[model samples]
Target chain A: MRVNRPKDGDPISVALNAQERHVTFDASRGAEAPPELVQLLTPEGERVEHPAYDIDLTPEEVRGLYRDLVLVRRVDMEAVALQRQGELGIWASLLGQEAAQIGSGRALTDADMAFPTYREHGVAWCRGVDPVNLLGLFRGVNHGGWDPAEHNFHLYTIVIGSQTLHAVGYAMGIQRDGADAATIVYFGDGATSQGDVNESFIWASVFNAPVVFFCQNNQWAISEPLEKQSRIPLYRRASGFGFPGIRVDGNDVFACLAVTRQALKNAREGQGPTLIEAFTYRMGAHTTSDDPTRYRVAGELEAWKLKDPIERVKAYMFKNQLADQDFFDSIEAEAADLGRDVRKRCLEMPDPHPLEIFEHVYSEPHALLTEEREQYAAYLASFEGGER
Target chain B: MTTLTLAKAINEGLRTAMEDDSKVLIMGEDVGKLGGVFRVTDGLQKDFGESRVIDTPLAESGIIGTAIGLALRGYRPVCEIQFDGFVFPAADQIITQLAKMPLRSLGKIKLPVVVRIPCGGGIGAVEHHSESPEAYFTHTGGLRVVACSNPVDGYHMIQQAIRCDDPVIFFEPKRRYWDKAEVERGAAPLAFDRAQIVRPGTDVTVLTYGPMVKTCLEAAAAVEQDGRSLEVIDLRSLNPLDTEMVFESVRRTGRCVVAHEAPVFSGLGAELAARITEACFYSLEAPVLRAGGFSTPYPPSRLEDHYLPDLDRVLDAVDRTFAF
Candidate 1:
């Protein structure tokens, strides 16, 4: 069942023969019984069988997924770089959140609805939403450029914990419609403190809504570490709300994939919502405006680098003879191409026409919008006549 | 069909919405068994069961925050803030979260949640209970705010608020909750966010809403007896105001007076004055006068009569507008 665990005979072993890779394996075990942390794949390349959880992913599928992860990370990097270069006004980097997002996002069926915070570019990518369109929002060209129905992805909600409630409500709607699809909501550690998030927990638990609250607790919510927000573990907080929660290694794609699948299935099967605290690290600054160096040290960043999500998968591939050097090289090349395309597309995005603001405000037109749009157009026209 | 008080109308509205849609849930302190402190949600839990009409803890933020979740789950949630003053605790959810959700979502999601707050001063109650905070929600985009001044509106508006695709802050004038009227319970509902001109005239446009609608109507009648024609406009929809109606009236009368129980500083009066001035600049012959509560906290019940902008105060503002 193991898909991406490292091997004993890989270059990684030769490079670090004296020391073993530092992974907290025992931490994966928890008090709960049945739905144990669904991990078919281990961090090492050695394949191991899991009695409860297993996956029958093919070689081509494995290669294809590796490519997706690489491309997604590259897009994330390009967006971050664009933000730093002032091409984007702001960016919420998904630097360390790639595996958790990609794993959970790929698990969703086409009919499933996704509710995301500002940092779900990886999930959006999995949903086939053009990443360039997401940049239009931060670039001040438009608010949100993608339609939710088109991609089954809700717009990025910025007010911390607000989207969780909306997700629960949407789930309630799904239940009323007698639909089998589940709703997945994404949020950060900081959002857990919000009244809305807590309330979402209450509603989801009481109503038995078909929702999976995927909390990517990347340890820090804008310089405030996890300890500042909660005294107990974040996953344990779900128990108080009458639901099961699990802590998974967010950096491990296999762990994230397996756990998220179980959680989503649990919801769709009418068992109610499950809270997933993807325990990981924020490998980059919170956003373009953030200076992580001011709050954290380089050593902390280096420490997480050893547990790199993509590197472990690469190691597993190399050790298991899943792919050759040429295959890995081609994937890297594809990632580079994705990076270049993201930059080019982001630059070419047109500033939304002023009239677009008045559109989609309501499905039906109103007298006020018409009058205001007319007045605004007149005001803009007057500016054109006066200014150089 | 049924003659009911505004309170009873609201109670029936909750009952009907819950009956029509199981997803339509009601949550607030005492909303379950006690039917709310004002009994506006009375007998709902008994009919629909505790699952639909829930009695939540005494946390305004908790009530609203969870309501947002319920709405997200495809449940049309109607949340009650125990009192006008108690809404402040959950103001962050209302102002920052609920107000901007639809726009932030780029219209991908519609928040059909209704926040019902019993507002305005007249019952000689505490300070926070009487304050009119509609301007705050009105200023916030992605939120529709409306106030019901009478039993008819109280009934129809509650149903309309529930049916709206957008989130609505339904402000029930606490003073007028007990006001009885021969309400047509089965009448067709009005538009979601449009103002209703309760009393029309050609002399001047008297813009008012909430409990002050009665005061403005009384003032308009008194001024008519004094040989001065006056138009009283009941602004049911505070946000997305019925500026067209006000503008049309001002264009004819060349004068205006705005009234509310809230303080005048940056209040609904200010909004009306600015919009009227912009839309009817050349038509206006005099300054827009405002009759509202004084620049002070809602005083004791003994001083409430003076604190609330009554018929005399509104007429004085009308006189001042004519003087201008």
Candidate 2:
């Protein structure tokens, strides 16, 4: 009854060597994108039309989108500076994916809920979460600074693809309640390889849960490129799970907004889940802790720089004459004010009470927690007299 | 009072909780139609309707991940993992997400979710079915782990777990599911976090939980013929262990024997032994002895009788404690 179990092999030697040549980021050859991508605005600020998704924005609406893009970029820039200045521990900079986040975030109604990954500061801004509150996590003062229930936005989930299943579950609850409100969950291309994400797609498809799976394909998951994760396009994985999958020019704010809005509408109208793959790139390191120079070439960044999310929006504003010079100056001033306020507030943020660690472990009181708290207090008091 | 098996009592408790709160829902694999592999959720979907009692796809991570979502939406979800060995697939959700979300939110939100797992070996079941993985949940910080020994406790604890605001890991002893006891249907049971002295004795204290409670109790009864009285305590809650009760029993008996189905290496017994030694060091007449499964993977069904702790093993540990 001896069983001959398979032995482990080198993944680099086995999968990489055989498939490396065939795996290409170019979407021209029967890949997941290029054909199904719904782009309302090109990289050069040219306006276009889509058959399934479109939006007729007023001058004010167009200016509002532009302001959102600039402000979010400002917040990201300030946070990066704060990290470099040693005010914060680490930061996940959303340098290139501003349009993808702001577009989908702004599309949500007051009733729609969003479950975000840790790098969704743009979405947080659109949800009206104070940018300073976002610093609490990076500053090592708190895990989350705002109440999720207050803004219908959940705390940022750091674990890769874990939030997708929760989004689907929340959507199922909304279905059971017979509510028209929908749920949107954001993740990265790296998270598409996680088991929880695939499981969520299956559950959402079967239960017809009202959720939007928004994957910002930022090309690199740390050191591994998109070629390492999937051979086909990520959105194509959605159709296999019995749902409509769409790709959008993530750098184009117009396209992201329109596609996301349509997806939410489909969910609210009981059409089930939709996977919107935002074809974008991470313009910076994975985080302040990472060094992209170790793995990626400088040319890749240069290529993505020409298709900058904020630059395209700014170009569109200039070409369409949607906003005046006064409006642009006011926005710059507002962004400066936000950055200064965030910096001051972040520096002044008080550390939480030492005993706060034991507070939320359980909702009800327990004997063990009481004992542990008492022990910790005594341990802390032992050092009180030594400082003198 | 009604005589019911432990499984039936849990079913009744679930029904009562669902009836009491409209937000209470049951979701798991084969939970709606097949009534669960252990039949613990039998006939629940029929009475509660399809919306409340959901039959989920065969994905453990999906079950728990969605359960967290439901909790966020103001629903008390009681998720059933079919077997103890099957809970690993959902470990990320259970340990990382569900357990840490409330703490991460800084008390702004609470996940009122109960994950019910049928655990421990003894029914002659094969791999991925019989296992005592309670230590994993108990080791996690934000979860409250509890195990029931009999029908009465099962009935009351299942309801209390559902009502609990924090996420609870409810470990049901699979071998004892069919064990019957008289349950007061409408009456209150013991507190969810308290331990009970199932049998009073003065010679030695026998501490155990879940499926091992029955074995320890039987061992205590058998030792009575040899003119030795063994005190037995059922530690219902594992995380917030009733240390006071354990210390009190050990002080009177002056000896302790901890028994469980999990491996002895860093098992619940190790923690209990350390705490008991710290609290009742002067009162102890002998060192704490543990009777548990070997430090190996759960063996096949044919060899489970030897793998799982039994009355003979419990008595052997008690004798060793006295020999010291």
Regions of model 2 farther than 4 Å from truth: A1-29, A32-34, A385-388
Interface RMSD of each candidate, angstroms, one decimal: 3.3, 0.8
Cα lDDT computed for each candidate against the true fold:
0.82, 0.92
Q: Candidate 1 at residue A275, lDDT?
A: 96
| Positional deviation of residue B216's Cα in model 2 after best superposition, in angstroms | 1.1
Q: What is the Å distance of residue B86 in model 1 from its true position?
A: 3.0
Q: Note the DockQ of each predicted structure.
A: 0.36, 0.85
Off by over 4 Å in 1: A1-56, A383-388, B13-27, B45-75, B105-108, B185-194, B200-204, B222-229, B251-254, B278-286, B300-303, B322-324
Cα lDDT for residue A280, candidate 2:
92
lDDT of 2: 0.92
Best by TM-score: 2
Clashing pairs in 2: A32-A233
Steric overlap count per candidate? 23, 1
lDDT of 1 by residue, A102-205 (tens): 88898899989998898998899989899888888889887675887788898777778877876876787687678889999999988999877888898789
